[model samples]
Target chain A: MSTRGQTHLWVVQRVTAMILAVAVLVHLVTIIGAVRGGLSAAEILGRTRGNGAWFAFYAVFALSAGLHGAIGLRNMAAETIGLRGRGADIAWLAIGLVTAGFGIRAAYGLFA
Target chain B: MAEPASLKVSVWRGGEQGDFARYEVPARANQTVLDVVTHIQRELDPSLAYRFACRVGMCGSCAMTVNGRARWTCRTHVRKVVGADGELELRPLANLPVIRDLAADLAPFFDKWQRAQGRFQPKDAPDGAVPEDFVVVPPASKARREADAGIECIGCAVCYASCDVVAWNPDYLGPAALNRAWTLVNDVRDGAHGDRLDAVAGDAGCHSCHSTQSCTERCPKNLDPSSAIAGLKRRLFWDTLLGRR
Candidate 1:
């Protein structure tokens, strides 16, 4: 990859890390609150379904995670196992796409 | 005469996958870890192998894991590293392939130095006469001072061994290499700032570092390679944005 592209990846990783930190905290707190209140999965689904704000938050979180994790894995593979070149890049791109697809699909399920 | 105080030292033996062999060596007052290893080799076993030069702290040789932490054995006093029981565990540096006992294969470690373009590439010919001959570098400048703080790295691989990024990613250029690149980048006479940034800006370069500061902590010289890597990151970001790299 070009030097600029690498810098962009590093920046994206930092940004995603920040997003994940907040998302994980919020998710954990919500889970704790629901469990303490004896909320059922059905009840949670009823409130979350068609909730635009929740859907948007989760979508952003998932996309960030997908991008961050894919890039990280690509770097790990290249450095640790000596895997590089176009093949590694393509594999990472595919992984990112799949993760983002699943994330978006789940978000849509909640929203639709 | 009272029997000499013998400390049971366990030194790693063999290749990448090996077991620690126990050796009984006489412990002396103010003896360094390197001294202990030397004694074991000289007195007990000629087969035990390790690497050391200068027997001081200059060559960056003599690095080994003492009590679960990477250290320059020549300078690391056993009292400081050993636990209350006076036991010492010596092994090869982490995150690198062990060539033999305490000697690791430094090919990958040094190769990354080349990848980072750590050498100074001067723009002008050595014999060429310049319009303004002297390049004045003021020691008082912040950049020069920042460069000076980490100028003493001995290529010991201590920082590299301590770095978690290197453990996670073997292709990572490592702390010492990136630190060298940072110094070269700040050099006023060096004309390859753009190329150096290009070399170190990538996935296996300074970008791989997670800012864990393990390099800073385990550095025997007390140099902050973490700061150097951070400087490279910032410089690379600016260079990339400005189309300089």
Candidate 2:
């Protein structure tokens, strides 16, 4: 890949990190408060189900996590494992797509 | 008078694959590491190979791995680097291939500087016409100040030897080269901003810097290559966004 493409990935990684920061904080605080307030798994699902706002928020969270984690892993693989070049790029993209796929599916389950 | 103290110094011998040859040298007050090496080569073993010049830390030509850290041997005192057991270990700088005992092949280091476009390209005078007016740049200008911040680098590979990124990625342009490129990038009168920016962008470029500040921490000149690399990153990011790069 060109350096420009790599730069774009670098920028995207930072952007996703920012999104994950906010998302993780909100997620932990809200979920911890709910559990401490005596909400069960089914009760949490009841609150999230049919909620469009919850679906969008969780979907965005999933996407950011996927991109952020994959990019970090890609760098680690390159630096540590010496996995580089086109093969590594394709592998990382697959990892990101799979991770985001599962996360968005779970978010859809909650919404539906 | 009490007997003079002697230090057990282990110096690396041979090229590529070699072992540390130990020597007992008389310790003197305010003795530099280079002095110890010199003593070994002169009195102990005439065959020991090493590289040095200036001997005053200005040239950075006498850099070597002293007691596990890359340093200017001419400036590093024996007292500062001796282990608790009063032993010293010297070797060639890390990352670069060793040419002999303490002399590392600096071709790759300098080649990366070229790869990073660490040279000034003057704006061409059209058709054999020389401009009469002088290009007077203010010393206090922002670009000049930024350039000044990184201009003191003496092409020493201390930052390169200390960088984990360079150790991990061979193709990665090490800190010294990238820092040199940063100085050139900020040269307002230089005509190669676009080319230099492109040279320093990408995975093996400034983006590969993990911001560990190892370069900043190990720099003997107190110059901040990490900050310079961050400047390059910022410049590249903005350029990409503005469609300039």
Per-residue lDDT of candidate 2, residues A56-111 (tens digit) = 99999999999889989999999998989988898898999899989999999988
> Model 1 over residues B196-243: C-alpha lDDT tens digits?
887888777888788889999989899999999999888766665566
Q: What is the lDDT of residue B244 in candidate 2?
A: 76
Provide the TM-score of chain A alone for each candidate, in the order shown: 0.91, 0.94
Q: After TM-score superposition, what is the CA distance of residue B207 in candidate 2 from its true location, in Å?
A: 0.8
Candidate 2 error regions (>4 Å): B1-4, B124-132
TM-score of each model's chain B: 0.92, 0.94
lDDT per residue for candidate 1 within A1-112, as digits (tens), equals 7766778877777778889999989889878877885878687788689899889888998998899899888877875777788778888988987998899898888778
DockQ of each: 0.38, 0.76
* Clash tally, candidates in order: 1, 0
- For model 1, the superposed segments whose C-alpha errors exceed 4 Å read A2-4, A15-88, A91-112, B1-4, B126-132
Candidate 2 chain A least-lDDT 10 residues: A32-41
